[model samples]
Target: MKTKPLYLNDCYIHQFQADITEIGDDFIVLNETYFYSRGGGQPGDTGDIAGIVITDTKRDGDGKILHYFEGDCNLSSGQSVQCHIDWPRRYAHMRIHSASHIVEYFLFRHSDNQKFLSSFISGGKETSTYEVTAAITPEIVEKIQHDANAFIKGNHDILLYPDENNPDYRYCKIGDIVYPCGGTHPKNTSEIGEISIKVKGQAALGKQKIVTTLMP
Candidate 1:
């Protein structure tokens, strides 16, 4: 059975009730879920289901979200359960995830080259990073950092919508850049706070890793 991913539209939803559709040895699948599965460089959310603690979450082969507890859930397939997500943790992820995009938008606009070789990021409990591909230049880094911070301070609402003409594309339009992503994000750019970028100086010949992170 397919599970409905609620975080797609309402990233702030933390508590809900759902019926268990399938029960496995150590995991359970709900008909609907607010918990975010691991993807897009963001880690999966950990929370509680009823009284049972959820250890990890993953998406199955058929796109079903499986909430895995450390041990057996001991629940039936048709059982009803209450889900309580860790909002603080989820919100932090949303902020950092949005910060990454804002940073990328600045780089994409400022830099002369648009082909990014490779990038990576981690929005953990304490901190987050938005690693992008760019050359290690003092001027480039400074400009991107300044622009990203300005955009964040502008408090623009990050609009999340589908491509009406091209229905297959889901767009999260932030400032001038439109990203096709399904990850969680804050309602506005100000919620992402300040973004800082740094050139790692280690990448392909025409590429570099620009680390965009939160400061204070």
Candidate 2:
């Protein structure tokens, strides 16, 4: 079943209506969904389907988004239902994810777009880290943090549009930087708040991990 991802078009959509397309032993697929299913290092969405609590959502083999219910499950295919995504939780992921990239923008600028070896986001509201092979000096670290915060303060506009040649892939444009992304983000950088960077020692052969925390 092909599920229309309403969230892809509008991340701020918290509630919507849809019909049940299919039902599995543990999950139900919706005709359309604004609730994001886990992918791209982001967690899946949790919410309710017609007042029944939903614990998690995942993508099925055919790419249909699955909504998993909590202790009780009482939904069927072809049934009309209302969807409510946990706005606070979903918004946290968007903010934190955007902040990390905001910091990453400067990180790559200083190092000329090096590959991030490994990265992790702890919980939905904690420090996120990414490892890079670029040289991590004290002065460089300070500069990256400074520039990132400044950009956030500027509230630079962020854009999302599908690639003309390949519609399945979406690109996020921030200033002159454009990269392929499908993750939800704030309309502007101002929502990312202040970002703090902690330079860590060598994590591998020559790569270093930078710990990022969202500060008030």
C-alpha TM-score for every candidate: 0.86, 0.88
Model 2 per-residue lDDT tens digits across residues 1-216: 789888878999999999999877778789999988887767888889899877888887787898887565777789999989999888878877777777777887776624666565644443334455555777877998999888888878888899999988998887666767888888888788887888776635565677777775
Q: What is candidate 1's lDDT per residue for 71-145, written digit by digit as tens?
A: 656678888899999887788788888887777777767775545544444543222222334454778779888
In candidate 1, residue 174 scores what lDDT? Answer: 81
Candidate 2 local Cα displacement, residue 36, angstroms = 0.9
* After superposition, candidate 1 runs with Cα above 4 Å error: 117-120, 124-134, 165-168, 203-207
lDDT of 1 at 146: 89
Q: Which regions in candidate 2 have their CA more than 4 angstroms from the true location?
A: 112-114, 123-135, 201-207
- TM-score winner among the candidates? 2
